[model samples]
Target chain A: MKAYDLSIPLGPMHPAFKEPLRVKLKTEGEVVVGAEVDLGYVHRGIEKIMRRRPWQKAVFLAERVCGICSNSHNLTFIETLEKISDVEIPERAKYLRLLAQELNRLHSHILANLALFLAIEHETLAMMLLNVRERVLDCQELLCGNRVILSYNVVGGVRFDTTPSILKEILAVIDEIEPKLRRYAEMFEHGPLLRMRTEGIGYMSKREAELAPAVGPIARGSGVRFDWRMKHPDYVDILDFKPVWREEGDARARYMVRFDEIFECIKMIRYLCENMPKGEIRRRAEVKSGEAVHTQEAPRGDLTYFVRTDSFGRIEDITIRTPTIPNLGAFVKYMLRNSPTIADAVVIYASIDPCIACLER
Target chain B: MAFPKLVKIGLRQLIQGPVTNLFPKTPPVPVPREFRGKPRYDREKCIGCGACVKVCPSGAVELIEDPTIENPKKRKKVEFYMGLCIFCYFCMEACPVDAISYGDEWLLSSYDKFDSKLIVRDLPEREQS
Candidate 1:
């Protein structure tokens, strides 16, 4: 019997997708033959909004681009402003900013892993992961007043300073969560069901990953040893940071990379808390007419922000390139590979950890 | 090995009951000291400077002049719409008189989006010296 090709559109509103992202797939029986993606569902014209707001207000607006990595958006925007104005941030502010960014990374990785587990029908594991993640959110709330939309970073520095008690609380939280994170890593490594679902699924070669130019965990999973944290020492010099990589270039590899990264981030946060510098949290800076670009390794991947200011210190243009955009290219490629079944497509897509809000914004 | 691992987790969970809260019946989870929730407007201290109106990212704050009085120094009333507040506390930071403060009122749900409880209005006559 000959198999007929079937066309299926997965999500703009499906249980598999965390956000509204539709993928057109052509399959023969259960194996996908072709795939195409549609973005811009969550686009709020964030760049246009930034251009209209004053330089000071734009930082808050930038944070609205993505809730999970809101601090990175604000930090990158402020860094761009600092570059245009040539403002020198205090050492204490730098450490605080790094702490917030790392904490965000920890939570985001856990959330991504949770989503993958949920997609694979591992509800118990997902619940356990989420329970651990709540502690991270609580820590964030204790530090910055809000759980998700931190609005922590200001133009020249951070919005608030940390106390000894706050640092102690943070250390306590880290100490508690680190062991649970290890258990999770162990489960991912040893669990037969998880291995069956993730291992050898959605395979991408190092060459393809580089060609697609995947960033963050997706790139590192494919054995591409590229991370902004290692390259940009000026921003992340405090931690003895190293890029985590896996040669498998599959869904399991990405899962392992993120799992290991959570531990790395925990170490970085501990370091920041230990050697936190004492100084002013913020310094007022004047913005002048200029253009500047800033890049940071967001939990998903490398996020770049380009800002251009006019002669009157008003924003002329603001553009953001989120990590999910390039990873989407890799997603399309992953779907078309190995003749993935419908189930495999969902797992592979979740593995990319696509943030459609960030992509559309 | 699998039996031991399963038994270990099961015994641990048995030792430590549930991690969730019994809220509404019990008290709500306590917010952190710096938790930004509902903005508490101090009518006595507010100078009607309209700074909060200007700095609010969500346009949650508004200043209205009292048209009933024909005096040159007509006192202005400040209105805060909780529905639009992002809880960033930008209004608190911008208030010169320190009239705006955030309280730990996390449960602010209502069926009506335009509920009167959502809007905190400072009458002109209530303005303190």
Candidate 2:
């Protein structure tokens, strides 16, 4: 028997990633033996930026943290500030915030699924998913005024309110999207090639997942039934929110978890829109000296934000713990196991859906 | 069965045609009513209060004094650098006289960062109050 060790560096710039992240893999023949991750290529010192900006303007800065889950950052930041000031957001504003967050989740999950398909060379499925995701973006643009960086959440409440026609448009978009998502789910579940590539590839036990203490779909995919949305006070009465989980604990299970969650989000959005309360959309609040820790379920996982404010309403200290940080441990562990092939390694890495911008920032 | 699923999806898409627009060749799609695009400044309505400058998050709005103009009323010029603008519409909200409004034109791309087209100069003398 002969063995050859080859070190290959994948990304910092590669087709597999939308952002820059370097992963050095030590391979023997076609099997990866060791892995080392190199991040900080896309770090912009967002926490430092947040501390420098005025508390009022920092919401926009927070929104700029990650282009995909921009709303989650804003929501977490505002919720932190609101907690410090002890301001109760109006019922209507809560519903509106929930709506925006779920819409963001819809787009983010679809994009993640699109990346998974693309990683496995399913270009047609990737394009079709992108096409379907556009409807969610359109709905977001209609509701929040911007598709990507929705500066919707202000200090005390949401920036804008919706009318009946806008609500109708949103419901109509949801009506169109639900069936497409169902078909996609069917394909993911029944498609042989997809299953061949994804199934039983990146196996993580419930013990490993619990030890990593992973949050979001990654953890749930391994049978850890935990979700921040269900426990969140704002969403408690809005809908019957439940966490989706699968026991397979592979790349396919993770994929299925995200796919099913999209449907869950669709149902949540529909329920919120149907039962939306009519009231003032925003309230004036004063920020005082205090600190708060807030958490919300970002598309990737549970995102947490800690914020401190001075008496004059300036940010004293701000820290953001994005989901990618916790999931990185599980990713490294998965890569180093069983000497998986390069293709399996890529799929596993994509399965964790590493957001370098969020992690390094 | 898996092949049949792909075939069905392909046929459905083939019948429906492409979902993307022929943009640039065709005109761009219309933005929503509240979209914060290019900021339009009404020179006549500006009161030289500099409120927009105070509220701009990116320092995109600047009040440049025209040394050439001796008249105090016509001396203050508002220079809006679209390059620095994040399209947050904070300036529009801060303008007390309704001098700034969000225009629907979002295609502000340029080869040069400081393109002349990127700067909107609201000269006080151009339009009399």
Candidate 3:
């Protein structure tokens, strides 16, 4: 083998990544032979700060871990807290939380596809994806009062209740966007440029995917259907979702998985909203000493939060293993290892939907 | 062949026109009434319970203790530093007396971030009990 032809550093501050992360690629002319990802640039010590805060306040810290998937973090933190206290929230609250999480999933999947299209230099598709995403954001704002950092989930239950009008507005927004979302899926599947650019690019094998332990769409795309939702108590009963997967194990496969999952999200959201239970939004939650863990499917993949609470209900220790950490490993080892071109490697990085802030938090 | 897939969307876009505001020419779409914008604290209504200060995630709300003052009422002070506010409205929710509220005014920019108009402070005589 000859020495590498060139090395390209993709970012600590680059357009490809909205956050600070660096991927060093060594290439032999056009083909990437090796890649080294350097993280920790956006580490804000959110976990350390979370440990110091009262257990009630740590969900906000978790919400700050990732801007795009704030609902996932916030929900996972409170679910872990509830687990520690053996708190069974009300029936209506469960459906409401499910609504928010699925809406968030829809929002995040659209963003991932948008980023992928952008990587392919398909600006029209990316802009259209963003336009479609605004509907999800509006629905979230209607449901939870804020678009991004929704402090919607409290310990005993959700903080806000959806009136009939708000639910109707959410349905209207969903109705308006569903056709557009379908169009995006078709465009990604059959669009000559998108399919040509993404199909067969950034291939990862099932065995490699397993070893990297990539969860969510990456694992599913690789033909190893490992999703936390199948086993998660919160979702297993509520969301009648089947895992969306593809056998290709390529960038297109990963994007397709995300695209298909949005339909499931839409169905689940509509079901929850139409059949929503009427009850109290929340009850005062009190806690005592215990340790508990929560694993949930964030938009990226499996996010785990493990916590230990003191006798007085103060959080003694908290460990958050965000999904992107493992997915980042999967990106470097499975997808980007001995890959084709440097450009393909970059698209592969986006294919994993890496949230560096979540990883570094 | 190069631009084949986007033809349908391109035609749709031609029909829909642009989705953004013209800034100076047209006012932007209004935020929903439920929108959580800038936070404001009512000095007259605050009982100095300090709930907002404790629950504020960023320490945007502070209890400016007047150590030199003799009166217990005068010594207890609550300050709203808008600069640190994350617009999460945790303070508004945490306020025991419902003194903290979200104002419609979202823009709080100034060369001096600490401008007097930007901050909500209690006068020493505020709510003299």
Distance from true location, Cα of A14 in model 2, Å:
2.2
Q: Candidate 1 vs candidate 3: which has greater TM-score?
A: 1
lDDT string, candidate 3, A1-361, tens digits: 4378787999988777767888888887888877778877878988888775677677777899899999999999888888888888999999999999999999999998888778778888899899999889999988887888888998899987789888888888988999988977887899787776678887888998889888888888989877888887757787755677889999889999998889989988888889898988888888878998889989988899999989877788999998888888887776776366777777888888888888998
Best model number under TM-score: 1
Model 3 misplaced stretches (Cα beyond 4 Å):
A1-5, B1-17, B64-77, B121-129
lDDT values of the candidates?
0.85, 0.86, 0.83
DockQ of 1: 0.74
Q: What is the lDDT of residue B84 in candidate 2?
A: 91
Where does candidate 3 clash, by residue pair?
none
Residue B43 lDDT in model 1?
68
How well is each residue in B15-125 modelled by candidate 1, as lDDT tens digits?
A: 995677766667777788888887678765777788988888888888887666555464675888888888888888788888877677777799987688787765323
Report model 2's TM-score to 2 decimal places: 0.93
Query: Which residue pairs show backbone clashes in model 2?
Result: none
What lDDT tens digits, residue by residue, belong to model 3 across residues B18-112?
A: 67877768876777667777655676677778888888877887787767667777577688877777777878778888887656666678888
Q: Is the docking of candidate 3 incorrect, acceptable, medium or high quality?
A: medium
Q: Between candidates 1 and 3, which one is better according to DockQ? A: 1
Please list the residue runs of candidate 1 whose C-alpha ends up more than 4 Å from where it truly belongs after superposition: A1-4, B11-17, B66-74, B122-129
